[model samples]
Target: MSSNGTFTENEEAPTYAPSIPVPNVQELVREDPSQVPQRYVRDMEDRPKDTDMSHLSSLIPLIDFSLLLLGNKEELNKLDLACQDWGFFQVVNHGVAKEVLQKMKDVAAEFFELPLEEKNKNAMPSDDIQGYGHIYVISEEQILDWSDALMLAVHPSHYRKLKFWPKSPTGLQEIIEEYSNAIRKFGTELLESFSLIMGMEKEALLGLHKQLIQAYRVNYYPPCSKPDQVLGVSPHSDSSTITILMQDDDVCGLQIKHDDDWVPVNTIPDALVVKVGDVIEMWSNGKYKSIEHRAVVNDERARISYASFLYPHDEVEIEPLIDPKTEQLIYKKVKYGDYLRNSMKTKMEGKAHTHVAKVETLA
Candidate 1:
C-alpha cells in the first residue's frame, strides 16, 4: 500500500452504509402538522413515557474535573457512583476552553443552516458512513430519526476522510480540529480516573487503548410540527468506551433511562455531559453501566448537539477484568474492530442489537 514511499490509509471497516438516502427532515418538518409523514411518527408505546422530569433533571450527577485532577479521592468516588448509577454526568471546570466550545457550536449551527444543496455537498456516500447523513437509516421502510448529522473520524489523522469535511463556513475545518485536539487530553485523563476507581494503575486503561480512536458526530434536530408524535433519535446505547457530549445550550432534548423512568437531562452552563458506553461496561466486567438514552423533539426550535466518541484500537480484545473472587467471567471477548463492524451490519439490516449479552454475577 505504499505510493512513492508514502503510505495511504484505506477505509478501516468494510462498507456498512445505509441502503438509501435519508430524507431532509429539517426541510420536511416545515410542512403542516396534519400532513406529517407516518415514517417519522411513533406509536404510543414508543414515545416518551414521561416528560415531566424537570424536577428530577437536576438530580443527575455533576462532577468537577479540576477537583478530580487535584487527587481528591472523594471526587473519584463520585465518578464511580455516577458510572455505576446514572451512566451520565456533567463535568464542570473541565479544561476545555469556553471559546472552543462556542466556536464548535457556532460552526455547526452555520453548517446546518446552509442551503440544502450546499449542505449535501458532503452527502454520505453509499459505500461509506462518514459525511452529512443519517447513520441509523437502514431500510426503505424503517422508521427514521428526526435528525441529521455530519460524522467524521477526528483522530489518528491518517484514517480521516478529508472529502467528507464541509467546504464553506471558512473556519469549520480548523475549529473542528482545534476542538478535537482540545478534548483529547481530557478524555485520556478521564479514563485514567476510571483505572484508579477500578483499583488498578492509572495508566492501565490507557495501556489497553494505545492509538485510541476518536470520532465526532455533530447532530441537528429540527423542530417538528407534531413534536410529541416523533423522536429526534431512537433509544440506543453508544458503542464507544466513553462519550463526551456537548449538549445544546439553548434547548433540551437528551434524556436517559434511569430507575425505570425516562429522565430529562438539565443543562449546566460551561459543563459537558460524559456518558458511560458499552465498552466501559464490558471492560469493567459490568462494574459500570451504559444506560439506554435518546433525544426528544420540540415544536418551537431546533436542537443541536456534539458528541466525541473515544474507542480502543481495532485489534485490541474486549476482555473484561472479572473479580475472580466474586464475579464470574461473562462477556465474550472479541476484537474491537469486528464487534464494531458487526454492530453496523445489524443496524443496516434494521435489527435490534443482540450482541453484548447482559453481564451478570455468580450467586
Candidate 2:
C-alpha cells in the first residue's frame, strides 16, 4: 500500500476470468419478484430515472482514524462531518493488517472458482436460514443482484463450527477464522470510537449489542460484457449497524451515490471501505447518513470481494440519539427484527433509508 492516500490511477485494470452470465433486464423482470427480495422497492418505484447517477462533488472520501481514535475531539468531529456528508471513507492505520485482508480476498476467490455444482449445493433455498450457498431474493421481494454471494452467521459461540464452506479451498476456514477475529477486534475498537464521537459512554453502544450478530458475505461478480447495461448490486444502504468491506486489489467496480450520480470509488490497495449502515443511522436519530452504494461487475473481468457486517443482537432496543429529558423525536424506537424484515423485502437500491411508519413493540 502506498503511504500517499491517492494512488496513480490505473486507467486500464484488467478484469477476472470465467465469465458469469447475467440475465437481461426483461428476463429478470419476467422471473418472480419474490425470488429476489430486497427492502425499498416501494421507494425505488417512485424514484425517477435520474436518481441513479447524479454527480457528487467528491468521489472518494478518505478518513485517517488514528488521530480521532487517540481522543482528538476536533479530529473526530471533522471525521464525522466527512461521513455525514460523503457517507463512505477509506480508513488507514485502523488496526487490521493488510496481509490479513489480502488472505481473505484470496480465499474468497478460491471459494468462488470451485465447480458450479459444489457452489450450488450451498445455495440458499427460499426457506433455509443457515448454511452454505447463495440466497436468491433472501431479502423478501427484491430483484436479483448480478453477483452471487455466500452468507455465514458466525458469532463467538459458532465461530469454529462453520457449516457452509467450499471444500476445494482446503484452508478456507483457517483463513476466515483469523480474518474474522481481526475484523471483530477492529469493529469493537471502531464502535468504541463511534460511541465517543457521539458524546456517549465509551462502551455505550457495545453494551447494547450483548449478543452482537456478525455476518460475512463473500461476493463474486462475473465479467459482464456490457458494463452499463446492468449493475452487480443495486444502490442500497446496508441494513446492519456497520459494513466493513475488503475488496480485490486487482478489479475496481464499487460506486456510491453522490449528489445524484453513482460515482465510481477506487479501492485503495490494502485499505477497507467502511460505511455507516442504516441501523446506526436510525439509532443516531438521523444524525449520521447511511450512504447508498452498489457493485458494478467489471465488463472485462470477474471480481471478488468480502464484506463483514457487524450487527447488534436481535433484541437490542434501537432509539433515537436524543437524551431522555429532551422528549424530542430523535428517532422512533423499533425492534431489530421488524427493521430486518422490512429491509429484506425491498430491493437493495437505497432501501434501508426509506422512512417507514414505526411499529410499536410489546413488553
Candidate 3:
C-alpha cells in the first residue's frame, strides 16, 4: 500500500475472480413484483422468520456525537456500553453537513432510477469488483439477493476508476467525492473516542495504518411480493473495522442478532447506524464484538442505503490489542488484505472469516 492509501500494483491487493453475471434484479421486479425466480429465492429454512422486535422493546443504543466531542463522561460511558452490549449503535447529531448527506442520497437515488442500459454503461468489468454491479457471487448456484447496487472506490480520489462512475447523473461524481471526506473525518473521530474508552492513547488505533482506505456500497432493494422469501443482503459481519451506514430514512430493513433473537433496527430521522466489524473485534481481542446483520425487503417500496466502510491499509496486520483486564491476546494476527479477499470470495454466512484469526486452544 502506498503512503496515500492507494494499493500500488506491486502490493498484495486482493484479486477477485469474475463473478458469474447475474440478471438485473431491479429490471426483473419491474416486470412482475409478485414472484421471485428460483435463484433469488432463499430456502425455507434460510428465509426470514418472525423477526419483529416488538418483544425486545428497545432500539439499539443511540449516541450523541455532540456530547462525546464535549468530553462528557456520561456520554462516553454510553459509547462504551453500546460497543460492548450491541456491537452496534445509532449516532445522532454527527457533525457532517446535512446538505452533503442529502445530496449524496439524491444522486444515489437518481443514478439508480436511470435506465438499465445507461446504468450498465459502467458494468463491473470481468476483472474488478467496483462499478455498477453486485458482489460475492462466486458461483452460478449461489442464492441471490433481491437487490441492485453501484459499488465504488470513493476515497483516495487518485485511486478511483472514474470510468465506472455514472455520468448521466451529473454531479453524482462530485458529491460522492466530497461526501467521502466528510465520512472519513467522521469515522476517524469516532475511532479516537473508542481508543479513549479502551484505555489507550488517542492515536493508538489511528497509528495502525499508513493511510486509511475507504469505500462506498450504495444498495438498492426493490419491493418484493414475497418479501420474506428473499434477502436484500445476506447475513454476515462486515469485513471493515467499522462501517457507518446511512439507512433508508423511512423503511426499516436492517436486523442484528441479539440474545438469540433477530432484532430489527429502526432509524431515527437522520441518525447513522454504526457497525463494529470483524477487524474491530480482532484488534480489541473480543472486548468489543462484531455481530451478524442482514437487510430484508418490504412488500411495497424500494430501499436505498449508503454505507461507508473504513479500513486500514491492505498491508497492515491486525494485531490484537492485549486487553489489560484479560492480560492476554485471544486473536492471532491476520493481514487485512488476506482477510478481505476471503470474505469477498464466498457467500456470507455469519462471521466466518473472522474466526480464521482466533487462536486455537486444546483441551
> What TM-score, computed on C-alpha atoms, does each candidate reach?
0.91, 0.78, 0.93
1-363: candidate 1 lDDT, tens digit per residue? 244432236636333344368788877766554455888878898876655877788789999999889869999999999999988899999899999999998999999989888889998887677889878566777877888889998887877788889987899999999999888889999998989998889988877875578889999998887888888888877778899999888799998888868888888877999989778877887778877888998888999999999987776788788765786765767787777766665442211342544433431
lDDT tens string, model 2, 84-121? 77767777777888788878877777777666667656
Shift in Å, residue 16, candidate 3: 5.0
Worst 10 residues of 2 by lDDT: 11-20
- lDDT by residue (1-363, candidate 3, tens digit) is 567654565643334445667899999988777768999899998889975675552657999999998878999999998888899999998988888888988989999899999999999877778888878888889999989888887655555777888897999888888888888998999998888898888777877755577888899999999898899999899988899999867888888888867788887877888999888888888889897899899999999999899887777888787855756667888888788877887777877767678777610
* Model 1 bad stretches (over 4 Å): 1-19, 30-35, 323-325, 348-363
lDDT over C-alpha atoms for residue 228 of model 3: 82
Error of 3 at 72 (Å): 1.6
Whichever of 1 and 2 has more lDDT, that candidate is 1
Q: Candidate 2: where are CA atoms >4 Å away?
A: 1-59, 129-133, 136-143, 159-161, 324-330, 357-363
Deviation of model 1 at 292, angstroms = 0.9
Order of the predicted models by TM-score, top scorer first = 3, 1, 2
When 1 and 2 are scored with TM-score, the better candidate is 1
Supply candidate 1's per-residue lDDT for 89.
90
RMSD list, candidates in order: 3.7, 11.0, 2.5
- Best lDDT goes to which candidate? 3
